[model samples]
Each structure stands twice: as C-alpha cells, then as structure tokens.
Target: MRGVVMYKPGDVRVEERDDPRIIEPTDAIIRLSATCICGSDLWPYRGAEPVDHQVMGHEYVGVVTEVGSRVHTIKVGDFVVGSFFASDNTCEICRAGYQAYCVHRVLMGALGTQSELARIPLADGTLVATPGHPAPDLIPSLLAASDVLGTGWFAAVAAEAGPGKTVAVVGDGAVGLLGVLAARHLGAERIIAFSRHADRQALARYFGATDIVEERGPAGVDRIKDLTGGLGAHSVIEAVGTQEAMMQAIHATRPGGHVGYVGVSHDVALPGNELFMSGVHLHGGPAPVRRFLPELINLIWNRTIDPGKVFDLALPFDRAAEGYDAMDKRAATKVLLTL
Candidate 1:
C-alpha cells in the first residue's frame, strides 16, 4: 500500500508502505474513500512539531473492509466516519462526553489516513457508520464530519453559540469558517468573522456572518468591540492557536462571555492573573469530535449544511505532497485526497 510519511520538517512523501491489519481485537481496517489535510498537520510541515519517519494525515471517511472479533457495531462493507482520535466511546470519560480524553485512546494519525488503507481501533465506539453508502458528491461533506466539521461544531458548542447570542470567530481557515457556519446553525443572532481575504469574507457571509473585521491585533479587537457597542461578542471562537489570536479572542469577548479555542496551541502561555480578572469562560483542547459525528452526519447527509465547501483543492492520493504544499502556502483552505 502507498501512504504519506513525514521524513522531517518541510518534507513529506507518498511512499510504498506495509498495509495495516487488525493488531487489536477492537480494531477494524478501512479502505480509504477520501481523506484530507488538517491545519494542525502544518505544525510538523513547518517544523514546529518535530517529525521523523512518521505516518501523516488523519481526517478520513472510508469503507470498512475488515473487522476484528471484538468489533460488533461496525462491520465489513460499512461506510464510516470517525474522529481523529480512536476511542472506546463507552469509557467513563467518554460517558462524560469527552472522548478525546478517553482513558484508552489511539491517535489515528499514527497509522495515517492519507493512504489507501487504515486501521481503526475501538471501531464500535470510534466509527459511526452512515445509514447506507452515500452518493459520490456527499463523500466530501461526510469526510468533513470526521474532523473539521466535528471540531468546528465542538467549538461552537463550547462557545455557547445559540439563539440571542452574538458570536465572533477569530480565524479564516476551514475550521474557523465552519465555526461561523456552526454558530449560525446554532442560532447565533450576530456572527462576526475576522478575515481580510475577499474569497474567505464572501464565504463567511454565506456561512451567516453579519460582519467582517479585516484588522489585526489591537485594532481587530477594537473593531469587534465597536461592532458590539464596546461590550464585545457574547461568544468568541478562537481557531488560531497563537498568542496574538488568543489575546484577540479574549479581548473581543465581553465580560462573563465564553471563549472556545480549538486551535492546536503551539507556544502559548496564559497569564492566570489576567484570566482571573477577565470574567470570561475559557474551554478548549482536542475536540471530542466523536460526540458530535452523528448529528453532523445527519446535517451533511440531509444537505442542511455543506461543510465540504472548505475543500478548495482536491488531488489523487498520490499527490498528497502537492496537497500539503498548497495548504502550507495558504493557497487552499482545505485539500482533499481521493483514493
């Protein structure tokens, strides 16, 4: 089989590799139908995250080709979507709706989904089978439900975006744009998107953003405050993991508001004194994507939402390097790899 492997920072290649098999009784093998690059993956591509000869890619939606003896809910021939983290959804932590922190968890990127085949552990709890094989066009959206959509949804949920709430999103990437969409779907009365790109601003408007702030740093926070009558947004979504983005999010949110940060924090340290005085709620980490896959799949399957629009580039699985390059250069919001 062929899969993507990161040889080091700024280097990734599609190379021949051994195929995967069920090494655990709870594992299942999936033949990739589609997969995509993630913003977090860029940390390694840009050398922020150290890399050796490690498998790459994680977002995936595929067909189950084999199942281990312990797998029951998922079976061979089932079309499934799963979170980046493989988890036994029934664990005590999972029961509390935090599957990303499940005591028994496996990071799927360790096996790499940007390949023709993948081994999914905890198949019963991690993989959610669609009602049936979906149409070809639906594949992209279904694939988004596996990661980006679920993560964005989790951000919106954590931010408490809903009716009567004023929401502000601090990123223009796929996850951030989808956070806008999720906020709208959750019934946010006002959605403010921070972006300067014309295309992204247009897409954000289509996703239900009522305002767009092109400024950066303090200016950006001021613009958000100006839009909200100096009180700031009721809910803020921080999709960029950086000190600047984090502070912008904190400043754009009103006192007693919520800030849901989903960006993979690279080098960030928050001041406890400021946080204590901010009078705002902060909650984030790896999203519990498994908790929202079912509802997200339903929305995508029914065409109620089109999160797949995020994939501005599509390539054959073999051209994954080019896909990575496109994203690293910010030429594409998201890149999808088809088998």
Candidate 2:
C-alpha cells in the first residue's frame, strides 16, 4: 500500500508501505475512500514539531474491508467515519463525554490514516457508520466529520454558544471557520471571526460570521471589545495554538464569559494574575469528537451544513506532497487528497 510520510520538515513523499491488518480482536480495517491534510500536520512539516519518517494524516472516511472478531457493531462493507483518537468509548471518562481522554485511547495519527488502508483500534467505540454508502458529493463532508467538523462543533459547545450569545472566534483556519458555522447552527446572535485574508473573511461570513476583525494581539482584543461595547464577547473560540492567539482569546471575552480553545497548544503560557482576575471559564483540549460524530454525520448526510467547503484544493493521492506545500504556504485553506 502507498502512504504519506514526512522524512523531515519540508520533505513529504508518497512511499510504498506494508499494508495494515487486524492485530487486535477489537480492530477493524478500512480501505480509505478519501482523506485530507490537516492544519495540525503543518506543525511537523514546518519543523515546529519534530518529524523523521513520520506517517501523516488522521482525518478519513472509508469503507470497511475487514473486522476483528470483537467488532460486532461495525462490519465489513460498512462506510464509516472516526476520530483522530481511538477510544474504548466505554471507559469512565468516555461515559462522561470525554472519549478523547478515554483510558484505552489510541492516537490514530500513529497508525496513520493517510494510507490506502488503516487498522482502527477499538472499532466499535471509535468508528461511526454512515446511514448508507454516502453520495460521491457527500464524501468530502463525511470525511470532514471525522475530525475538523467534529472538533469545531466541540469548540462551539464548550463555549456554550447558543441563542442570545455573542460569539467570537480567534482564528480563520478550517476549524475556526467551521466554528462559525457551528455557532450559527447553535443559534449565536452574533459571530465575529478574526482573519486578515479576504478569501477567509468571505468564507467566514458565508459560514455565519457577522463581523471580521483583521487585527492581532492587543489591537485585535480592542477591536472585539469595540464591537461588543467594551464588554467583549460572551464566548470566544481560540483555534490557533500560539501565545499571542491564546492571550488574545482570553482577553477578548467579557467577565464571566467562556473561552473554548481547541488549538494544539505550542509554548503557550497564561498569566496567573490576569487569568484569575478575568473571571472567565476556560475549557478545551483535544476535542471529544466521538461524542458528536453521530449528530455531525446526520447533519452532513442531510446536507444541512457544508463544512467540506474548507477543502479549496484537491489532489491525487500520490501528489500528497503538493497538498502539504499548498497548506504550508497558505495557498489553500485545506487540501483534500483523492484516492
């Protein structure tokens, strides 16, 4: 089988690799129908995170080809979507709706779904079969549900975005843009998206952003404050993992508001005194995507929301390197790799 591997920063290649097979009784094997590059993959590609012949990609949607003896709910021939993390889904933490932190969780990135075939551990707990084989047009959105869409939905829920709430999102990446959509679907009265790119700004508005703030750092916070009459937003979603973005999100929310941060933190530190005085609730880490997969799949299947619009560029599977380059250079918002 062929899979994507990053030999080093700026060096991605499509190479032949051993095909995956069931190694656990609870595992299931799937032949990928479609997969895509994620914003987080850029961390290793840019050297911000170490890489040495590392397998890439996590978001995927595909048809099951094999299932272990313990995999009863998901069977061969089923079309499924799964989270980046494979969890037992029956653990205490999972029962509490935090499957991302399940006691028996497996990080799927290590298994690498960028390949033509993948072994999904804890199959019954990790994979969600669609209502039926999805339409070709719905495949991209179903694939999005495997990760980005679910993560964004989790972010919106954590921020308690709903009717009468003023929501502000502090990033314009796919997840943040989808956060706008989630906020809208959840009934946020106003949604503000922070972005400098005109294309992203337009997409953000299309996703339900009522306003766009191009500024960053203190200026960005001031702009958010100005829009909210100096009180700041009722909820803020931090989708960029940076010291500046984190602080901007924290300070951009009003007292007693909520800040849901889903960005993978990279060298971020919060000021104790300032955070204590802010009197805001902070919640977010790796999103419990499994908790929202069923609802997300139904929405995507019904065509109620189109998160697949994030993939502005699509390339053949062997051209995976080009997809990485396009994303790293910001030439594409998201890249979908066709099988």
Candidate 3:
C-alpha cells in the first residue's frame, strides 16, 4: 500500500508502506475511496508541530474490506465515515456526548488514513455506516463528514446557534466556512464571516453568511459589533487556534453569549481578568465528531447540505505532495485526494 509520509517540514512523499491488518478484535480495515488534506496537517508541514516521518491524514470515507470479530455493526462491504479520534463510544464521557475524550479513544492521525488501506480501531464506535454505497458524486461530501463538517457542526452546536441568534465565524478556512453552513442549518438569523480572501468571502455567503468582515484583531471585533448594533454577536465560532483569532472571537460575542473554539490551540493564553469581566461561555476542543456522525451522514446522503464544495482542488493519491503544497500556499481551500 502507498501512504503519505512527511519526512520533515516541507517534505511530503508517497511511499510504499506495509498494508494495515486487524490489530484488535474491534478493528476494521477499509480501502479508502477518497481522503483529503486537513488544515491541521499544515501544522506539521510548516514545522509548527514536529514531524519525524509522520503519517499525514485523518479525514476519510471508504468501503470496508475487512472487519474484526468484535466489529459487528460495521461489516465488510459497508461504506463508512469516521472521526479523526476513534473512541469506544460506550464510555462515560462518550455517553455524555464527548466521544472525543472517551476513555479508550485513539487519535486516527497516528494510524494515518491518507493511504490506500488503513485500520480503524474501535470500529463499531468510531465508524458510521452510510445508508448505502454512496454514488461517486456524493463521495466527496461523505468524506467531508469525517472531520471538517463534523468539527464545524460541533462548533455551531456548542455556540448554541439557532433561530434569532447572531453567529460570527473568526476564520475563513474550510472548518470556518462549514461553520457558516452549520450556523445556517441551525437557523442562525445572521451569520458574519471574517475573511480577507474574496473567494472565501463568496463561499461564506453561499454557505449563509449575511456579512463579511475582512479585518482582524480588534478591528474585526469592532466590525462584528457594529453589525450587531454594538452588542456583538450572540455566538461566535473560533476556527483558527491563534491568540489573535481567539481574542477576536471572544471580543465579538455579546455579554453572556457563547464562543465555540475548535481550532487546535497553539501557544494561546487567555487573560483571566478580561475573561471574568466578559461574562461569556467558552466551549470547544477536538470535536466529538462521532456524536454527530449518524446525523451528518444522513444529511450528506440525502444531499441536504453540500459541505464537499469546500474542496476546490483534487489530485490523485500519488500526487499527495502536490496537494499539500496547494493547501500550504493557500491556492486551494481544501484538497481532495483520490485513491
């Protein structure tokens, strides 16, 4: 089997690797139909996160080719979508809707889904079978359900976005754009997306953004407040895990509002005094995507939402390096790799 490995920052290659096989009684192996590069992958690619010949991707959607004895619900030949974090889905934390923090959770990135064949641990808990084998056209959307869409949906839900609520998104990446779509699906009355890129701004509008704020830091917060009649938004989604983006999201929410932050935090610190005075609720981490997988898969299968549109570039599996370069250069919003 061939898989993507980052030998070091700025060096990604498709190399032959041993094929995955069942390692646990609850494991399942799938032949990937499609997989894609994630914004988080860039962290290692850019040297922000250390990489030592690390396996590259986490988002995937594919057909099961093998299943362990304990994997009853998901069987060979089933089409499935799974989260970046594999969980038992039966733990106390999982029962409370926080599968991402399950006692037996495993980070799928370590297993690396950016390959022709990959093993899924805790298969019954992590993988959700689609209604049927998805058509070729729906594959991209199904693949999106694995991570970006799930994370965005979790962000919107955490922020409590719904009818009569004003939602603001602090980033313009695929997760943030899908956060816009999630806000709309949840019935947010007004959606504000902060983006300097015209293409992303257009996509934000298409996903239900009522306004676009190009400014960053304090200026972006001011724009959000100005549009909200000086009260700020009822809810804000922080998709970029930076001090600036986090502060922008926090300052852009009205007092007593909510801020859902899902970006992978990096050297971010919040001011205790300011947070105490703000009187806002903060929630979010690695999204409990397994909690929303069934619903999300249905929505994608029924074509109720089109999160797949976020993938602006597609490349063959062997050209995985090119896909990473495109994403790092910002030439593509999201890159889909075909197997």
Candidate 3, residue 66: lDDT: 93
Instruction: Please give, for residues 139-255, the per-residue lDDT of candidate 2 as tens digits.
Output: 999888888889899999999999999999998999999999999999999999999999999999999999999999999999999999999999999999999999999999999
- Residue 38's C-alpha lDDT in candidate 1? 93
> Model 2 off-target regions past 4 Å?
none
Off by over 4 Å in 1: none
Residues 115-222, candidate 1, lDDT per residue (tens digit)? 889999999999999999999999999998888888888999999999999999999999999999999999999999999999899989998999999998899999
lDDT of 3 at 241: 100
Per-candidate TM-score against the hidden true structure: 0.99, 0.99, 0.99
Clashing pairs in 3: none
Supply candidate 3's per-residue lDDT for 291. 95
Model 1: residue 137 alpha-carbon error in angstroms: 0.6
In order, the Cα lDDT scores of the candidates are 0.92, 0.95, 0.94
C-alpha RMSD values across all candidates: 0.8, 0.6, 0.6
Q: What value does the lDDT take at residue 286 in candidate 3?
A: 97
lDDT of 3 by residue, 1-339 (tens): 999999999999999999999999999999999999999999999999999999988998899999999888998999999999999999999999999999999999999999999999999999999989988999998898899999999999999999999999998999999999999999999999999999999999999999998899999888988898999999999999999999899999999999999999999999999888988999999999999999988898888999999999999999999999999999999999998
User: Where is model 1 poorest over a 10-residue stretch in terms of lDDT?
Assistant: 270-279
